[model samples]
Target: MESIWVGERVRVRGIEPEESELLMEFDQDSTFMRNNDRLHPPRSKAGYRHYLESGVGTPNDDEFGAGIESLADRRLVGWFGTNGIDKNSGVFSYGIAIGTDFQRRGYASETIVLLLRYMFGERRFQKCDVEVYAYNTASLNLHQKLGFVEEGRRRRSQYFAGEYHDVVLMGMTIEEYAAAYSLGTVESS
Candidate 1:
């Protein structure tokens, strides 16, 4: 199968050490952190450099971590990470974080499509799952729009912003992905 990571507006590529400062800047944004990863405190720029140098943002056999860049200007806009829950069983999960400036511009959606195409179409993963915090309406809506069903919810499981919030568990099987994003070649059966 042909590997295609570039979408109409964005492309996936290895994260560079110099981009650590950009990522650290995103981590410092409270609004972005609150929705994406509120629990972990933002790391220092030097810490981020060390983290990236350790290969935390590169694809490996068990998982993948990459930078999302704009196809137009090639500027880094976000980050994406994915890993197998059970590689042998074809189960996996992925998450993304687009910079505040990049939000609402379709980069997140296209990045997801590119990731899904790679995971489901090329890698042949059977299922993909994700957990969205209840307060993140945009994410919930986006996942729903992308055809990920709300499989269940974990109530009051995550505490952030001085309140406990529900964790919405969503998933999509290969069949559902094929049906929703039928590229005319995906197997529907």
Candidate 2:
């Protein structure tokens, strides 16, 4: 699980203290967090330091980064990871965000695909889930493209921009992931 994952022209490696600055790709960028319903707000450098240390500080925790060629020579682009794992039920949640400079290139979707493969195929998790704001078309589209189905809607759950917003819950079980990825179904384009 510590080995770096390479796919879709990017590399995903376990998070490190070096990646503490790297986390700004997800934490400080509000636009990136738009689709990530469960993420807490952006934090200052010290705040982000504490946050990353507690969440993925352990080498065994499996938090990782998805990065590509440098902005100039070679720069880390973004990150994605899992959390809230219920070991007994094998259910867990996920988060992802590409850098503002590196987004819209299928990186987020690819990250989810690679991570889902690791979770369902390698780790044999029973299910994996993610939540998105109801209005986030990109995130909703990405989740469905990966075979996650709508599970429920949690109404009026978040307050932002001086108003409340509803959130949608979606999930995919190992069976669904296997069926979509393992079978290699020809998805409609």
Candidate 3:
């Protein structure tokens, strides 16, 4: 399938069934798993294949997954997409995770921008929201830098690593996204 979204450094595409093993590897990443809250146990190859297949042709699926491929080397650097998409309200929550080897290379930011463009410009989403743990300062700063306004916070709601952390909620409207990147004017690399 053709890429759904393309950025200067990466492209967003659906996760293929053959890539199930790759996702299983990502699930085994200790550092990546630690940062994000894991509600379920790690998945086996077969389990992950089922998970990936479930999203196919399901427009209103609670969690939609996409693969982030680096344009430079055509490697799978990350996985991300919208979760909890409300069709009627045009609102959705997003989550992203880049492999440890791919961290600090600006792939997250580029991937996020491309996802926003697709959501606002193509999907016509009214608002995009994200919840981040307070301990993830880098993500908080990145969201703010991308123009997501801090809407609210839940005080010490998440317990991880033997400490309670606040969950910060941030959001951005389509208008705000337009103002930030000018949508169609972004030059692809």
- Evaluate all candidate structures by whole-model CA lDDT and list the values in order: 0.84, 0.68, 0.80
In what order do the candidates fall by TM-score, top score first? 1, 3, 2
Q: Pick the candidate with the highest lDDT.
A: 1
Task: Give residue 13's lDDT in candidate 3 (0 to 100).
Answer: 72
TM-scores of the candidates are 0.90, 0.76, 0.83
What is candidate 2's local distance difference test score?
0.68
Clashing pairs in 1: none
Q: Indicate the residue-level lDDT of 113 in model 1.
A: 81
Residue 106 in candidate 3, Cα distance off native in Å: 1.6
Candidate 2 structure quality by residue, lDDT tens digits, 1-189? 223255645666545556667776455666566555445655777766776667543545444433343323345667665787787898888777667767677777766777877776666578987888888887788788878999999999987656688888999998888777752233355
Q: Report the candidate with higher lDDT, 1 versus 3.
A: 1
Report the lDDT tens digits of candidate 3 across residue range 1-189: 335477778987776777888878877876577675554586788898897787752444345667888999898888886786887999988889888778878888888888887787877788999998877888899899889999999998987667887999999999999987846654557
Arrange candidates by lDDT, descending: 1, 3, 2
